[model samples]
Target: MALAFGLAWVLFSIWMSLPWLTDLGNLAHPLIALFVLTFIAYVPGFMNAFLLISLVLRPSSRRETPAQWPSITILIAAYQEEKLIGETLRSIAALEYPGKLEILVLDDGSRDGTAARTRDCQALFSALPNMELKLVREEHNRGKARVLNHGLELASHELIITIDADTRLEKGCITSLVEHLVASPPETVAIAGAVLVANHDESWITRVQQWDYFHGIAAVKRMQGMYYGTLVAQGAFSIYRKQAVIDAGGWPDTVGEDIVLTWSLLRQGLIVRHAEDAIAWTHAPETFTGLAKQRKRWARGMIEALAIHKPLLSMRKMRTMFIWWNLLFVSIDLTFTFAFLPGLVLAFLGIFWLAGPITLLVLPLAALWNLVIYRIQTRMLKRMGVKMEKSLSGFLLYAFIYPLLMQPVSVWGYFAELFGGKKQWN
Candidate 1:
């Protein structure tokens, strides 16, 4: 993902350098033309090319496992999530890994029946010869980082897989992830799996989110994995080498501990790879407010991780370049947006002569780019065995609108991270 963004910059610069494209008219400042064109031409082209190459280059099948399967401990962390915890547990119990596996569900002092649900799952799944599920309870409500750190101490195996309480794995997710790990080199410490929206049929918000997951998160991970640049081992469904995590000091106490943990591994020169075939379905925020809060928390986490890992900002490595590029590009985009809006006012007032035709060209170009991404992601969804929702047409129509709507939200996230105190998990 980081590498793609860097390449996007290089690719877009090449696109803008074409004399025929930029010779439309003269501007008071050349960078105004360059920055405007970056969003209009460079972004879409980069995204399309990056996604296609990543998917094409991704490993088609899991490598064959060795004769002896390794032992793994699956950790489930719950905080006030009583309703969906059982289903998650059931899914964990139903996983079809050939290796030895045990599940431990830690209750983070839920005020409801989360602990009871955990007990129920423990009793139900423990009888299975292969599935041995255990229940752990914390006396007080602490954050997820504390629970996971404690889990590391209790884990009996050298490998740990963390699944959120609201997540349900596909039958073969664990097996696939472990296979990917076995296939990975010793320096690669973790693998992040693909996460799909389970409630995709709920609404347009969720449907687009489903679309975004496929195009945005999954595709970007594949690109990063190609170069060992996988940045974040997302907590929803990820596998880790237990000792590597222990050496990195377990999960960091941050709003985005998962991302921070990945960065910590990178600081120690450990590589975090990604496996797309390991699938987990999760519930997304269906309401607008819920979605906004979720995006805010996510943005804040990225900001916090970047702040905590400042030493890597200039390490002259691919991963460092990726992080530095992301921060730089976000700042650049924010600047372009501020200028472009007033530039729009100037164009409407007939001050900037070429702005009209350029605007006309850019919108369709952006939509066309999204359509290309949609077709690619559609194929990925089919191969991943995901069911297309009833609102396929709605998703198609909203692809053009999705990018426009996210601008303010992205800006809000940056501002919130800078000024907001004590971020809450919604």
Candidate 2:
């Protein structure tokens, strides 16, 4: 980690010393130039360089399977998910884990027949050996965090796994998570599973998100996990030490419950991991409005976590670097929205105010970084017996058009949380 950081700083220093960049600083107002060059070239450039170096230099470790599989309780928080709850339970039943397993469907007062569907599936899955399926119904709509806390209170095993109602685990998902978390040091308390878009074929929006998931999201998680503390052990599909979660005070009541909970664990000096092979398929939002809402909430969640876990910055741990690095994301997003996008439009209109020669210098590095991430992710998927489809359109959109929409929406989310916007759990 030190080597990676050192190399990144050296390269950044070299870039800053370039004559044309210095000339730009002299030509423009200091504040405007600093904002343009820092966010556009400096911060993101350093981050990408660090991630690339760390990834290329990451050491490989042999994965050892556990001799005995520990019992696990699966928690699914459902609200108006009648159409998907049955399939989600069926997917859990199909898992290859041999250990005693318990499944809890926490129905958070769904207006639909979610509970009925769960109960019907419960009867069908009852014949499975060494498995118990139960439904816990709430009379009124409690949010996801509270529902998961209730499930935590009733969880029957030491290991707890949380999956969203729209999530479907691969056959080997549970085994992979168990193997990774158990092989980790005793302090390792949670492992986030790799989540991919299941409905990429539904629309162009989902298709672009598929690339985001398969490439960008996976790369970020792998980079963070390399240092032994993944920031967000996503509730979409993750495994946690039940006792560790209890020690962390269960999930917090926030839009980004998963983010806050994971940060809380980190704040307590516990290690969280990511299992790249533990794959889960989740439904992505098919419409633009849905995607914006989802990304906004995610952005808001990051802000909330950072605000709540401010003391984590003072922690003397290797993973604490990631906590500090997260502070740059909102600034990067804001600059991209308020500065870069408009500059892009101006450049196309034959004005080179913000999007000129210096800005274009970042593209080659960005392309190389994406290429590296894509190859690594594809190799991972290939090993899992998953085939990549040839989707030129999706890749192009994800590369060029996705950011134009994503950054602005994320800025909205940051401001929304700052101003106490209405919090709704989709």
Candidate 3:
């Protein structure tokens, strides 16, 4: 077939054009090395652009009619969330599209008054008709995977939404997410909620993360949601079609249960969509230590999630490709994290000057690319009608500083998870 020959030719051409690794990494010209590295690295990004364009053109499942409201259960796993759970319960009681809803809160051995607060909320929402609240408690601490596995079994509704205790739902969030699931084909198994950092103004660390979530995750989810195989349907605010969860073997006991669940659903050839309109506000870590711990847990969990799923065997091309993209970059990301900038700085100190004017273009060109990425994210957020913070400082950090910061943290996470260190969640 002409198609097979064309593919072979393209592969051969690319292989022939690639420079030897040792020569490419330590070139005579510092700038040329940087440029060459950048070019080869972004080859994947360019290939992924086709996938992004496909999703952006048709962000939804293309259904326009009203979907019938279904009976649903919202599940929340709580620890020391006493400060936030009351408001979370109130937000659920305040749902505008209250058809038939049951709320289940699992108090996973919190030493604090998290259990008592839920009881108070139970009394508060007692009069809210068609809304049921079931509170469960564990005498001691167990991991999130265990808590959620139990919650999924306890839930009696056809549709289930998993929420974090600290998340506050916007008025239309529940309605929008459920409707997106309802409108989707029966094979469309889960929906991811757009998570915005509510505590962005609480501290400098939170402020930095605010833009990262808004500008980074918001756009990434929209693109990934295209074929309904977004990597992670976050536990913070995710809706699922129940039978699909049962079919996918419930939530697994991995550091990253949410992502593993998403992968499992995809492996089974079910869809996991992103409902950008279904908004949820959750608190971010307000300190560097806090943020690092959170990221480390997430990173370690992600590695574990990837290991457990080992998705290449799946017959679905799109799902396999998505997993492959994430898996493909472990060594590359670590290389850039440790070597790239440090090498450039050391080269300058060692009097390794640029060979020509061409090498001087890397920094400015990279800065421009960052700016473009931020602007695209801003436009996406505006399209979704999410509010943007007016901090020029945050915007600048988002464009330049955040990428460097994330790399080291991810590296630390990989090591920590591998070595069995750092395992506490607040």
Candidate 4:
């Protein structure tokens, strides 16, 4: 599918560059330019669609050995999580893993009785046989990476599963994730669990974001896993092999430790797999300001990770193909950042100067393409048993407005990191 898309784009570009196409008129050049830009933007979408279709058609090849379940240490890094800490602990203790599982909650200098609440939860769980809950509190405020590493020092299991304090793992989530690692080769280092929006019913904003996760981010990840590997392992819920992480020098103290660690593991020749069956629910920001801050932090973290790992771009000894694939993904993000204004300008000019019928046809083509992708994505989510209350109209609003609104903020995040802004752990 990627090859077909590339071929189509190349042919389109060559045709547009032809002398006759350029000689058509001023209006013709803009139309040709629009065609070229549309093709370029469509590449990522095409690849994503291809991947999703492939994963859906493929047979399940997971192993069925209960004896192979490895002991897992669950790590939750908390900072002022007074309201959610108890619930997080309760959920971890309730997981149905067959093997031994230890729970560690690290408090990053929270003054709001977070440590006290964690200890109380630990005492509550102390009666459960074979389950150990430990609370490690720091006097000073260290970042999440450091707090996680501190918990790593006391881990008694080879498999370390990291969970955010605000996340709740579904029953049998651990078992589903561990099945993939045991079945795969020993080099499989990290496994990403599926995360659904816990607060989807909260507001319109969260509902839209939930759709984006299920249809956009989650769909792309499942597809990416089919070709080479999963690109980004979301931080909210992920499982990592302790040895692989330690060998990679532990998680980097960055805003996006999950992404950084994923890339680092890839560079070390370790496979990072995505376990779609391993489900967890997490809360999304309900307000626009909160959502913007979250996205900006994410964007800044991506830029910082790219800068620190720039050497991976030219390293031939590593997985060159995968590296190039990741670079292409990043290029798509950067292109989207700058593509909108120019696209709108050319589109308007084409409407005013060129045949009105031609412009009308082009606009609907883009919209229709987007709608088709959304329908496929929504169907996939429904098949996975996710409930959707909002109709197609809500999704349409997101498809048109959200991407354009996010562009300026993403661009701002890129420059902010370049000028030396620290990654806040709030």
TM-score of each: 0.85, 0.95, 0.84, 0.83
Query: Each candidate: what lDDT?
Result: 0.74, 0.86, 0.72, 0.69
Ten contiguous residues with the weakest lDDT in model 1:
353-362
How far residue 399's Cα lies from its native spot in candidate 3, in Å, is 1.6
lDDT of 2 by residue, 1-426 (tens): 645664665476447545645555777775677776678777776777777777777666335687888999999999999988888888888888889899999999999999888888876677888789999999999899999999999999999999999998898889889988878888899999999998889999999999999888998899889889899999999999999999999999999999999999988888999998899999999999999999999999999999998999889887887887788888888889887888889989987666666666567666877888888888888898866574678889999999889999999999999999999786
TM-score, cand. 3 vs. native: 0.84
Residue 104, candidate 1: C-alpha displacement in angstroms: 1.6
lDDT of 1 by residue, 8-110 (tens): 6556556545562356325445666666556544554454555455555555634558678888898888888889998998887777787788788888888
Candidate 2's C-alpha runs over 4 A off are 1-28, 388-390
- Candidate order by TM-score, decreasing, is 2, 1, 3, 4
Clashes of each: 0, 0, 0, 0
Best of the two (1, 3) by lDDT:
1
Tens-digit lDDT track of model 4 for 167-225: 98887788878887777777788888888778877777787787677666665566555
